[model samples]
Target: MKPNIYVVPRWSGTIHSDWYDWLAEQVEARWQVPLRRLEMPHWQTPRVEEALAFLSEQVPGLDEGTFFIGHSVGCQSILRFLHQKLTPESTSPNVGGLLFVAGWLEVDEPWDTVEPWLDRGTLDLRSVRERVLHKRVLISDNDPFTSDFARNKYLWETRLGADVTLYSGQRHFNQKTAPEVLSALREMVEPAN
Candidate 1:
């Protein structure tokens, strides 16, 4: 069966915004992949637990054929979910891959909304790494919300063992379309030998 693709939106983000809709269309048309853009609850004032619960309920079958594309805080939600759900004794299957856009370990602004996430500490990379088959992070060189590019890139690389890509000026990546993201998704699903 084709892999199930889930797109987790950013804080205060909508499934209708950015390149989400375009990605869904392209994935279905090109690869026959089923991509579902999840609408996170309480997006304006997001809580980690809430987001995790929502994802658990939404995506109950996180098997080897499952893939995730997360934006900003939604990236955190996906990582945290993996960290929380996967265990050596658990019957849950390992996930296929993860593609995080504008993902971050730390942020420059919006302390009020981001403080809870920052306070949650780092993810259990050992377990998460073992469970996830592929991991990639897409970042912007000039993102206002995430200024410390080097640090963010370092964490995603060293901790999660993810391939980090730095784009020139895709600030926050809230654009109408993202061909780079689509290309990355294609690579993840159809990796080059």
Candidate 2:
């Protein structure tokens, strides 16, 4: 069976914004995979618990046939959801993969709104790393909001065991189309030997 693909959008982002729609189109057209573009609750002012709850309600199942592509804060939601849901006694199979675009461990500005997310203490990635079969992170060198590229890259690599890729001038990856993201998703779905 073709793996189910879920696209989680950025904070303050909609299903139609940026590359979400384009990626969904490409995934359905090329691979014929069932793709879901999640419309997060309170996207403009997202709270971690609410986001996770929304995911729990929206995602029916997770297993080896499940894949996720998350952008910005949506990345945090995905990781947190996995960390919360996947326990030692969990019976579900390992997830297929994850592709995080413009993901961040730290942010640059708008401290007030993001403070809650950042202050939630260290995210335990051990469960997530163990449960996920493959993990990849894509970030921009010049991302305005998530500018600490080196630190973010280090954390994603060391904590989540993700293959980190740095792009030039991608600026939080809010463009209309992201070939890099599409390419990475394809690789995760059909990895080359």
Candidate 3:
């Protein structure tokens, strides 16, 4: 069976799945893999625990064919979900891959709304790395959220074993069309060389 692509959006993200319509359509038209964009509850003031629970409920089970793509805080929530929630067990299935865009481990700029999710003590990158088969992290050079690109790159690549891709001016990537992202998703869903 073709892998299912699950897109988790940024914090305070809307329920409107149209944001990912372009990428979703491209992937579906080419590979026939369906895309399901999850709407985070209480998007105005998001709580990591709540988002995690919601995602857990939405995706009851994951397999080797389940692929995840998360942006910004959505990336943080997804990583935590995989590490803290989906513990290694005989019954739990391994995930195919994970794609994180503008994902950050620590917040340089303090914001009260996002403080709960910034507690890195609660996240276990090692466990997350173990649960997934392949991983990719994307960051832009001028991304406001991630001021220190080197640190972000080192964290995901050196520590978590993800293939990191850097872009020049793609700030936050909140647009409907991202060719690089679309291409990456296409390659990931396709059979490996």
lDDT of each model, Cα atoms only? 0.86, 0.87, 0.79
Measured over all alpha carbons after superposition, the RMSD of each candidate to the real structure, in angstroms, is 1.4, 1.4, 1.8
User: What's the true lDDT of residue 102 in model 1?
Assistant: 92
Model 2 lDDT, full chain set: 0.87
How many clashes does the backbone of model 2 have?
A: 0
Better of 2 and 3 by lDDT: 2
Q: Which lDDT tens digits does candidate 3 get at residues 1-193? A: 7787888888777645334777777777876766788888887888877988899899877888888998888888788788765665535777888888888877669699888887465555776688788788889888898788888888788667898999999888877788888767666666478
Q: What clash count goes with each model?
A: 0, 0, 0
lDDT per residue for candidate 2 within 1-193, as digits (tens), equals 6889998899899999898888888999988875799999999999988999999999889988789999988888898889877877788779999999999877877567787676234787788899999899999899998678988898889888999999999998989989999899888988888
Ranked by TM-score, the better of candidates 1 and 2 is 2
In the predicted model 3, the residue pairs found to clash are none
lDDT of 3 at 141: 86
